[model samples]
Target: MKVWILIFVCMFSMPLLVAVLHFRMRKGQTLKIRQDYVKNARYFGRSFSALVEKALPEMKNGMIMLSRQEKVLETDGKQEFVQPEIEDLIIARNTIFCPQQEDLHFQKEIYSEKDALFVKENIRLRAVYSKKRLLFGNKIRLLRWADAEHAVAVYDECDLGERVSSGEQLVIGFENVFHSLYAPVIRLGQRPEEPDRFMEERDPRIFRMPVMNSYEYNRHYIDDDMVTEGGTVPYTIISRGDIKVIEDIILQGDIHSDGAVRIMENASVLGNIFAENDILLEKNATVLGNIFTQGNIIFEEGASAGQPDKIISVVARGTITFYGGNNIYGYVVSEGGGKILKSDREISGEYCFPGEPVHEEKITFRDLSEYENVDFQGFRGDIYVKEAIIPEGASVIPKSQFFECRSLEKVYLPESVSVIEDYAFADCHVLKVWESIEKLSLKSVGISAFENCYALEFVSLPDSLTVIGGAAFAECVSVNKLIFSDTSLLKKIGDHAFRGCRNLKEVYLPDSVEYVGVSAFRDCSSLEQISVSEKIKNQPGIAELEKNCPNARIRFREVNSVEKE
Candidate 1:
């Protein structure tokens, strides 16, 4: 029993001895760690102090001083300058630290890597890194600042040639070798310019405006015709009634008439002319700007519009006719028809005469099976057939050939067809199905070829197609899917090509497609998936499509790889 009691006492004392030894070792480790931390902190403080001392001299010298005179000393000459902290420099430059009253017409100009102009009331100027031109409209002060060795200069002024009538002060600032300085001030007032004789001498019957002036008049007739010789009109002239310019007239501003406008021989107009009724330009007439009319427009012999390189459009709701020796440098658009009578006339721009669509009750194509080839160059008959078949070996479909066939439900395209021109099947609201004759040899589908076909649900593009022109399938709201042929050679899809296709759910764009124009697939609200190559997916055209259909899932694949949906 004594041996057992000794053993118990030893066991309890052993635990107490072990606890004292553990506490002593832990205290020694804590003391060493504290000493190491203190040594490292002292070294870091010395290194940071050395860095601040090295940067302080540069910071002090970089401070910009705005002075009234051009020559200024860097230091105060007698005493040594004390360098301010980086935070102090930033606060001094920031408007928040030194608030100033807002200047009403403050204009600021700063020279960036690119030339940039800014106009603001109270703002800090930042350095520019690229070369670009920027214009701002307001009055502001220009601020130039320097940091380290980099220097920036800013100047504020109105655009040099801008006409300002109000008395405004212009301030110019720049950075010199030693200091930032402002140049001598210049105050400008509105100049007194004389009005044109025609504008000064107003007539009740004729609308007359000088350059930089505008006027309106009632029904006017220029019987003398020579009254507009050497006349200058910088602003618009509007008339409520018919206008007749007899002969040898010259005017600068645009002319708008509610009734018919007639310009006699040797008349020249520098600006656009519009008429609610017909417009007639007689022999030797020259127009520099566009001509638009609701009624017919006629250009007689020796008439010219626009320069050779510039485009001046001529548009008319009715027919447009051009006589001999006419040189038109712009486009001509007519809703009804267009006729060019003279061979000597030169038209540099396109002439579009989308002839009236056939509006007849019914159309039949019973003889289509017998014909090996069909040509519809100027056919004006209705194409609203209940059923139509283009037999094999049929070659071409001319522009506007089958436009506005509202009742057409089915169409069969022949394998041998090579060309389908613009607006071939436009406005075919009921056309729901298309059957091709085995293989298609078609090369091009022109602008607005199948636009507004509301009943079309799906389309399988042919392999031989190379071009799809602008707005080819626009407003095809019911088209749910578009399948590209495995061997498609398509290269271009023009602007607004698939716009307003609300029900389009899936589309497969082949790697052969190189260009997808602006606004393509815009407003495709029901689009769920699109498959495209990586190169095509990153293009701006795809970005535009994504913007319009935010819910569409885009699957990008490498060229010649299996497509993912």
Candidate 2:
């Protein structure tokens, strides 16, 4: 009995002991972990210069300060001055300025409170930071970077190196090859004291925005990997596998890949690029819009991004590497980091400019009688079709029937046609001239049926359209309104059916819609209102449409009884 009593006490004591030990070990201790700072790169530098000045005085890591204007007289009648050889810190006493000696090569990062002037010849520096202003005279070579609190003025023949950033203005006098520069006012081969043109000009006489057209929402569905030869592709590309550009080429729209994207030397892309994997830009490659990647972004020599007139963004979840001779007119940001790798020389090759391109495939197509199963697939010559009339008594439009008709303007469907198969009108870049389909029996539209029709305007679907397939009518930039009759039978809207319709302003759905697929109206930036019947407002997918279009107002209205007849 005594042994049993001891066993019972021991069981409770063991747990008590563990609790005491756990509390003792954790006492007066709080976990601390170092996390990398993530921020929007566009607004990152607004307070950087202020933060630098605030933190510099309280810095403790081997920093020397000349706080007093005069030497301190000690009690022993001794005076001492620490003239250290370290070039990392320079605190000016009573605003006294000090300059680097002539022809000196600075290996470590140097900071100064006064003006940093490198007027002498052949002065090489790894990097420089100044609190006031920075000036680089002729024959100065910056190996890595240079930043200042105020202006960073470069002379006519200096090597500006990888990055030159300033909190205020940046002035470059002459043609000096540079990598990346970030400032509000950048004067290239112009004077800083002269009138500022980048900010002042209300309307430029020379520069004007061309015809507004965009294919940002078009996700071209290529099944497998693609290997393209040197040529011009006049549409967007979406591939499940990797895309390898063998030679110089030009793409007129956005590019997305499930795998990697490697643009060969001398290629040009006139739209945004996104990849699930890494994105590589070879020698002298150019991309006009933004570039985003889940992986890294690697820039080869002589590669360039963005135009001189505007700023673009290059964001990476991983790192960004610039080998040399790479220029970006905007943000270069990465969650991991960005580095400037040294390269001895720029890669020289045949560059492909965007100027050369043959006219669209010309064919005044009138009918699809020659196509297989009465489909338009027989006309695969990338032709410019003015209008195509679906023959009388045609029941279905086959898959990929009108794929990539370069300038297909209009299409007329017969009253007997009921279904449009997958990829049926995809890549019809300018197909917006067609009017209402209220008379036809369009029961269902297959996947990606009318994707990438950039100029499609307001669409008024018939009451018979029951199922809208995935990505059907996606990327229709000019599609501002979509309408359905009060008595319409639109049972479902497939996933991403109207995705990337940037100008989609309003939607009017019928009371008969049973389901709306995920992300049906995703990325519709201009969505103003979504009107639905009051009876179906609480249905399965009815409430979720507001999530896809967050700025759009959901209007639940009572349906008119006249259309029920």
Candidate 3:
């Protein structure tokens, strides 16, 4: 009887032990899976942060430090320093100090210290203990230090230049440093590790000086009709009145005027420009940076501003007009009316004409087949038609040429058309089928080309398509099918290309696609299927689409056998 009870107990205990072991192992796996998910999420966040940093202006590098015992030498009625406070200094390895005396003063307290100040080889200033001053409210008191590798000593206010009889060892050298003679020096210590990641990277040419009620204009050219002649101005030019650059001059810095600023033909500005009144850029004038004005802004023919890769802007509180043939590479914002004369030239960025919203005025086309070979060169305003066919010889479609034409139903593009500039057919709510009448020779579609076209269901891309700019088809909520030709040369799909397309069910990507920008298909709730060649499986943007559309099925096909859906 004793042996029988022992066997039964052993059998029951073995099963319990096995069950407990299995439970523990499963719990461990679950915890590890959760940790891995968090890690991946963090990595994605970092990648997006880095991408945003890259898009913005690069930050300024290095630090600025002032020397102790530097006294202000009074000369005439003005005081000058023995050594100019603006002299550059080397603080640590890879760290520099170049303070602008005028802008460096008047800083009350340090903004940060943990990542700003480094001391001794390992210790870093972590916190400020007190607001007490060491030399007449000039020096700040530090409270704590992090990663201290050596013992630290503190002392009361005393002349460090004189030797003390006290035998206390000073681990670090010390003296009351004058950050600035006038303004308060708020920031100190080492420069940021990645100094090239800053907002509105300070234009190095901006005159860093104290705030003043007004600026003095260069009186050397006061007698001359043109403020600047055919020479380079190395520093920023601030004018109290109207200024004109009559000759071919190169400005290394920015220009600011309280009145009108006029740049003649053949002039170039490498920095930003601002005016309280009107600004006029003559023909062939080029500005590498942005332009802002409180009054009207006018660009003559062939005038160029901004760069292709930079985010430059042209803003005017009043009207902005381009007299045709201007090549602006960035955004333009006008509070008042904006007009661009008809020309073959192109503006390559976003344009905001928020003045009076123009409603669509439809012109009925009953026999659209008769106008199949119509020349659309001087065509303007809205057209109401059932079926419209583009002529075979049409070469270009200007910006906003058919904007907000809600009555448009079906439109056909011609083979000779190469460029469709920004907002060419934007806001056409009822436009459905946009097909090429012949083999398409289309090369580029500008920003917001088919945006907000709610009834657009099908779009057939041509074999010659190369680039689809940002927000090209954003908010096209009813697009159900998108087909890329078998011999498609499509290379890029810009940001927000198919965003908010709730009814889009299927898409076929070609093997020639090299880049799909951020949020290319975001908010496509009904996007159920995506077919792509196996060549695009390793693309970074492919993961973005998968993450945004969790329920969408991704079907990878061999390069030669990409099926049309």
Candidate 4:
């Protein structure tokens, strides 16, 4: 019994003694750690204060200025500027600081080598790519260089999940909420995958409201202004600020919009657009200017001013069709099929004119083969001849022949022919008349008599001509020189008839007439000089004479009679 009592007492006392010693040792370590921490904190504060002074000068203006000394002390040994930190922040040009810490707000901040805040943050980064502006929002903790998959997420900061895989696409912001940052897009490339589905998935609030940038957005805009994968589009999303674009834009340069692009009455776009699909412009939604497309073009019924002389060319794969009334000025060509349905209107040909009489002759296949020519013995009626002759006759006379002959080369007018009808000899090619009609009492020449004659170079009209037709000598590409002894008929030049006559170098028209056709002397590329009578100076066509013919020099000669000079 005495031995058992002794053993128990020893065990109990041993336990108490061990507990007291352990408590004392723990207290000593805690006190030592506290003292050391206090001592280091003072040193850190002093070093940071000195370094803050060193970095102040390099900070850019307008950025929120921080208390440099205080911020440095809080960072403790991590303050890189004063050389007190264990790790140093590397600041590079055109780079942003993406802090990994959760407590930090800005993932990317402008990197400045001299700013104390950047120095304390231990920012380590490199320049990825830069442009005019950059924006960010949401709880995006891990910031890395943008890849094809992460592009949309980086821009919108919304969870795209599997919908946005890669390639190019237009991303709509969340509800009336958009990423707060605005950047200019220079170049964009997009490969469409289910274009309609993507647009349909866009949030309505984002589509309805005006957008802008936020502080949570990158405070600093991009430098250098480059666009690697986005473009400036004619988007109808609501936004308050001016939408500025720096690059030549393309939605592929082609976009497929799911809904209507409605621009409010006050909104405007100062750029051009091209669409891959049909464009639906709702009523009251005004497009200020031109819109182009790669596919079919459709306009909803309403008063809409598209573009002035803007629909220069419209190409269709199947059939290009217009629904409502459209005013088209330029030439319209259809490769597949061109079908025109004219509404209530009368279309008639010009039948009555005071010129050559080519249509009145009783031309028979037998007459064309017999004389190698038909003699118009001054019969005052219009006549048409193709690859035939006008023989000199006392009773019967052939009038103006081959007025609008699309294909007929040579014509032989008889010497007895006195009154040549209007445009009788117009548009004739390879016409070689061997001076058969001598001293003929020719009175009038038709409009566009030799228009577009690529082969005829020189020909002589009768000296007794009084009325010269409008556009009589237009587009005679091969005819280079012409002479007229009658100075009085100079002012009666035809309209645009001489246009594109690349070989026509000299022309002489008399001053007897007063009215000239518009575009008469246009595009005479080879024309060296023109002699115009002073009497026709104030004529209507003369005002625009020099504007059209740049190669020709006009000689306002004092004229009673003149030849090609």
Candidate 5:
């Protein structure tokens, strides 16, 4: 009975010892698993493993492998496997897949220095997908030869396996040791939009500057816009359109254009010109011809044109401005003043002449001065001022003949004046125009009479005016704000009449204007608002005006109530 009791005690103690041993074994296994997961998570966070994994499919002839312990890659087969000699790693990242032969794709590590490889010229290159194809030793830079050195790569010549169809398996090795495989290429049916892989695309960096030289043509002239890309020519005549002297465009004869004319450094035009656009002469530019543009004119310092006795006539639609150092030996007519530098020189129908001993008309200034006095009496025809000289007691009496005073500015019309003729004061920069003219005596202002005056900003129109011709104030750039009280006289506004008045901010039109010309305010960028009469609603010109100035505010109201009438 005592022997039986002892055996029972041994059996019970044996289970207790076994239980302790099993518990220790489970704890060791759990620690090992936890350590492995932690190590992998740290590596992934440190190296941006997820981003590399996404970019790995772009690599070609290369593979990245991730094992339980570390990460490795297999590059092109051949040579001493020099890991540091690799190039165009980004190209490999954009071309080849990390795993080409296995179902489980390896998590890619693009930042890994050892994950990229490139085979140079005169070396054996074993393709990733081919066993039968072997490239002979030839001097060629793999992947590095692509146009974009940073990201894109293209192999000059490469061969793959025959069985590598749309979907196929490719073997991958770690450090030249074969380990796994994956499928990468996907063959497809005929594609029409794909670019031919053989043809090279254009790179913007390869463009070279154009070389230009002057060429002479006696009777022949180049009418179209000529663009040069760095070549040399001799004495050429450019006419009609925009002429750009990028390089030295030397002309033995005149260079004329109906459009804009631009001259850069070391350029010289020895002839006269008639331009419709602005003329821009850059540094060291020289023009031997008279420049006439229906637009603005600008010249940089060190630019010279014409002479005092043989001066060039400058006609502009807006202002004719020049740098302080530029020598302009010609007559400049702006709606503003002369010697205008650093300031805006507006072009009015005004001209400048030297003082004469005796005046041709009844009004004369005994002593010639920049500002003189004028006398208007006993003159049957319209009185005229030869120069910019203003005479004392100058008046525009009834039945007077005044056609074109090219250099007239700030002339006060007498209260007795009536019926001003057409084209009278056509381009005057009369700053205080019509200051003395009475409402009843003033009847008409000729067509195109006050077109391009840079300084004639305000005008007090007479209520008695009955007839205003076309193009009354076509291209007045400096006339920022205008309020017309007389609406019964304005009938028509001429075509393209106000094309380039970039500074005209506001204009008030009355119902008395029955017709509006085409492109009247075509390029008036500063014209913020225009109020038209209610009578012009649903009209073609009004519709065109709205379309052209979509940014400007338009208002349509009864003619009588437009301006507190």
Candidate 6:
């Protein structure tokens, strides 16, 4: 009897222990990129710089020279592909030094530790790493890449060949061309105008209090693939299958897809594009906001992301392909490395200034045969539900899976469900979930998963919740109580998460929360108190939180500092 009881205990307790460990591991691991692309892109160059240092340790095998003459005599820079000792780089005082001067070709990599590095006019170099600063003269070109710790300046008509980056400031002169650039501040062409200055100067629109008349949010939940050829879409789109946007059009809202996304010629989107599969953009296509994906991203000829003044992000976890002349103003990163492809039209294997075109078969937009398009738009995405039940053992409840299902209240989730993806139950007014689950095992609630649910009164968060993405509960006016378990592993509350929640009264942050993103609890007029530990209050964006909630009293709870992973 004792043996049987011990076996039963081990079986039940082991599963529970494993579940706890899984959530703990998930909480500890940090993702490099997500929906908030523009905010997190500042670290792109520094991350690559670290990887470059590790890969080519010879670059840092340099020493500071006593004088400019000693540095000049160290390496005969006129020749190409000249092999030197491990300390191949030259470090001197503030002097104009070009390793490949006579023939204008420097094949070896250069690194400077304590001095500024400068290059002469019309020179071609392999790679350069500057510890202090890097400056370039007229019409210079780089074969591989260049980066600096302090600042980088390029004079007239320079061609920053592949990747030129600076963690601090990067300034470029007239008519310069490059494939990619990453910096906190990047200026171009004698321009004094700041990025987003135009946006700030625009006349503010008048806001009139809206009277509730409709329950639908004009945002479409298309069951089949939908094509956006030419027209105006003033609302959001949640697509289930592959979506194609051909021709020129301006979209005022975001586009979220479960499958691939193809943006054809001259199309411009004012919002974001979040895709599960690959994203393809044709020539002259523009996205004012972010473009992110788990799969590869391909750009066609003259295709641009972001603006000349405003900064945005174009990222892909898989390989990123740029078919010449494709430019991105801000962050352009690919975990699987970036490739620049010339057109198949030209047989010559030389790279050109304006870049060659992409050879692609342009296809017409196709609306699938079995298309079922459902569009809804409301004051707060008003679709009503009282109760619901999910199928047992279902690990994922995909976004817009229950599009037309109403008359649901409390949700019955399987213990295996770890993530509720973006817009999974969005606008489901009065939808109360998590009462029937025997074991609470949820980890992540994706972006806008529960937005605009005005009838929701309370939500009890379990300890397993780690991430609550952007605008998760925005405009939920009737949300009165939000309970977070004492042992919660919540680390991040994303941007505008609880924005415009008029009736929310109070919230207490667990010690596990490390970050409260921009405007996470903004516009909560009825919020009376926000209790958090001193460590949470000292976080980077926590101070800005108070400015958003003018009426809320932020009470810091006295507690021991929590150890972070």
Best lDDT goes to which candidate? 2
Q: On a 0 to 1 TM-score scale, where does candidate 6 land against the true structure? A: 0.38
Local distance difference test, each candidate: 0.53, 0.63, 0.51, 0.36, 0.42, 0.58
Candidate 4, 1-565: lDDT as tens digits: 9999999999989989999898877732111112113222113223433444356465453222334322211222132243322122233333332333323322222323211112122222221121111222332222223112112222212221211111121222221111111111100111111122211322222111221211111111111242233322323222222222222221111112322232222222322223433343322222323444434433222212222212123332222232222222112222332222222322123211111111212333334323322222111112223354555552222244454443455555555555555555554554544354335666655665655556665634456666556656666676777667653333355555565677778877665655666666667777787777777766656656677677778888675564432
Clashes of each: 10, 0, 8, 56, 53, 14
lDDT of 6 by residue, 1-565 (tens): 9999999999989999999998888833223234224343334335544544454434323432222212222343233334423223443324433444433555555655433344456666777776656777566777778877766766555767677886555655455656666754444432211232322321111011111222223233322133234234454556777766666655545677888888777666556788889998887666666899999888776565654323467778887776644445566767766655433332123211111112112111122211112111111211233444455555665665443223334566667688877877666655654563326688988888877665655556767889998888787787776767667889998877887898889888887787887777777888888888787776644686667677888888776665544
Error of 5 at 414 (Å): 1.2
Highest-TM-score candidate: 6
Q: What is the C-alpha lDDT profile of model 1 across 1-565, one tens digit per residue? A: 9999999999989999999998887732111112113222113223323443344344544442222111212221122223211112221111112112333221221112222333343333321111222222223322332111111122322222211110111111211011111111111111112111211222211122222235546637554432444343333568988887667666555779999988888776766789999999998676767899999888786565653223347778987665644545434557765544424223223311112222224333435443321222222123435556666556766677667766777777767788878988888788885765326787888898888878876666777787888878888998888888656788888877897899899999887887887778887999999887777775655876667899999988778765322
Instruction: Return the candidate ranking by TM-score, descending.
Output: 6, 2, 1, 3, 4, 5
Off by over 4 Å in 3: 1-392, 410-412, 435-438, 559-565
Which is superior by TM-score, 1 or 2?
2
Predicted structure 6: clash tally: 14
| Model 6 root mean square deviation, Cα atoms | 18.3
For residues 1-565, what per-residue lDDT tens digits would candidate 2 score against the true structure? 9999999999979999999999888834223222224442323233433444565566564443334121211111111223323334333423313343456565555555666666666777777776777778667878878887677776555776777777555666543556556753344443334443331221221111121133324233322233234234555677777766544556655687888888778776766788989999988777767899999988876566654424567888887776544556556657765655533332233211111112333333233433322212233324435567666677787787777775678776678888989988787888874555788888999998888878777668878889999889888898888988777888888877888899999899887776776667777889998888787676544566666677899898886675442
| TM-score-better candidate, 1 vs 4 | 1
Which stretches of candidate 5 lie above 4 Å from their native place? Answer: 1-407, 429-432, 437-440, 486-499, 558-565
Q: How close is candidate 2 to the true structure, as a TM-score?
A: 0.35
Residue-level lDDT tens digits of model 3 in 191-238: 111121111322322111111222336522222243345334545668
Where does the lowest 10-residue lDDT sum fall in candidate 4?
Answer: 181-190
Writing each residue's lDDT as its tens digit, candidate 5 over 326-381 gives 44433344432222233232322321111111223323333333112111111222
- Compared to the true structure, candidate 3 yields what TM-score? 0.34
* Candidate numbers sorted by lDDT from highest down: 2, 6, 1, 3, 5, 4
